[model samples]
Target: MKQFAMLIYPGFTALDLIGPQTVFSTFRDAKIHLVWKTLDPVTTDAGITLLPTASFDTCPEELEILFVPGGVEGTIAVMKDGEVLDFLAARAEQASYVTSVCTGSLVLGAAGLLRGYRATTHWAFREMLPLLGAEPVDARYVEDRNRITGGGVTSGIDFGLRIDAKLQGEEAAQLA
Candidate 1:
């Protein structure tokens, strides 16, 4: 069974996390781990809070996939956070694929994963992608090899479905 780690931070977008959560959790064979900075409930951008399944230090060593969700805080946090950036950069090397939703691309870019890669993010942050050395693709969802990125909050689902097809196969993804 494939194990996926969904990384969420305070002030993250609810749709960015829940959209993929709903889609991926339907697969009984796959284990989805919610990773956060702390175990305490963290509020989403929409005012909803979720209790994380694991903290950063407690996350499983081997993750087949990693999903990073974006929010207002992510725009600032992921940019200047060396701890988060190092954590992502290290794990991204071993994970089968690394992905982001909305401004989550900013996080990925800050981690140095988007260097020389064309990616997309929330329309609001589209112009800022160059700061991380990434080219903005301006698509709702952009897939470049092992990296998949989505635009804004709602686009996370489409990004998840695209990844589902790539990782699990068309039939499996369609079922999702």
Candidate 2:
């Protein structure tokens, strides 16, 4: 089975997380894991709550993908969290793909995972990527090596489809 681990934190933008998740769900052999530091409810920026299905401590040792979704304030704070960054970095080292939507790319950068990668994010924060050592690009989505990031929230679907094709094949992405 293919396993995917998605990080969840308070104030994460709903669309950034949900759009890609919807696409991933269609794969019958894929196991989607909503992971947080704890197995508790995380409040999104939209005020909706999402219950985490797995905890960081219990995440699968191996994963096909490691995803992070962004929120403006949350992303800023997450960038400074050592434990979270450490977890993400370690996971990225092992996963086949390390991805983010919107400003989630900043979080990946904070983990020291995107040192020389070309990436994209919410337009307003594109300039800020330089602070984290990522080359900022203006695009709906970007793919550099195994690190992919989407621009803004709605672009999650586009990023997801790209990831689907990488995970499965062109035909699988077409079906989605």
Candidate 3:
């Protein structure tokens, strides 16, 4: 079975996490690990709560994919969270694919993973990517080889489907 890591942050959008989670979890052969800066329970901007399976430093290192879901608090995270950025930076070195949704793309930018890559984020944050040296793409989902980005919250489902196809195959993705 392949493993995927989902990074959770305070004020994250619920659909950004839940949509991809549902699509990935539908496959019995896949393992999804929800990770956070710490192991404590985290709350979403919409008030959904999740108990992280592990902390950033304790997550499995051999993940097949890493998914960063956007939050309402993207700017603050980009500017303030060293642990989140460090973890993302380190993980990007080994993860087969790095992906994000909505302002989650900002987190990737913060980690320096999206530099020079064409990516997309929430419509509201589209203009901010240039500040990080990323080419902003306007799309529900954009797959730039190893990096996959999606726009807005619900776009996570589309991101998941695209990744599923890449990692598994169109038939397996359809089954998922």
Candidate 4:
């Protein structure tokens, strides 16, 4: 089974998390883990509450995909969080794909995962990418090496389908 880990924190955008997750769900025998620092419920920017399936310490050591979702206040806070960054960095080392949606790229950049990588994020935050050692691109999504980043919120579906095609196949992505 393919293991996918998605990071969740208070104030994350619901669409950012749900879009990709919906696509990932179509994968056969895949395990999607909603991970956080603890097994507590996280509230999204849209006022939706999501339950975490795994804590950072309990997440799989190896992952097929390591994903992060983005929001305004939450993204900023996560960028400055050492523990979350450390966990992301460690898991990313073994993940087949390291991905983000919207401002989630900023969080990955904070973990130093986007350095020297060509990436994309929400348009409003594009200028800030250079500061994180990433070359910002204006597109729905950008893929550099094993790193794939989606643009603004709704772009996550496109990003997820792109990844699905890469991991599965064009036919599978279309089916998804």
Cα RMSD for candidates in order? 1.4, 0.8, 1.4, 0.5
List TM-scores for all candidates, in order.
0.93, 0.97, 0.94, 0.99
Model 3 Cα lDDT, one tens digit per residue, 2-68: 7789998778888998988888887757688999878888888888889999888788887788988
True lDDT of residue 23, candidate 3 = 83
Q: Model 4, range 23-126, lDDT digits (tens) per residue?
A: 99999979999999999899999999999999999999899999999999999999999999999999999999999999999999999999999999999999
The C-alpha stretches of model 3 lying farther than 4 A from their native spots are none
Tens digit per residue, CA lDDT, model 1, 66-163: 88999886558656888888888878988888898988889999899998888999998899889898989989999787888899989888888887
Model 1 stretches with alpha carbons more than 4 Å out:
none
- Evaluated with TM-score, which candidate comes out highest? 4
Query: After superposition, which runs of candidate 4 have C-alpha atoms over 4 Å from their true positions?
Result: none
Q: Considering TM-score, which of the candidate structures 3 and 4 is the better prediction for this target?
A: 4
Q: The CA-based lDDT of model 4 is what?
A: 0.97
Q: After superposition, how far is residue 22 of candidate 1 from its true place, in Å?
A: 1.2
The true-versus-predicted C-alpha distance at residue 149 of model 2, in Å, is 0.8
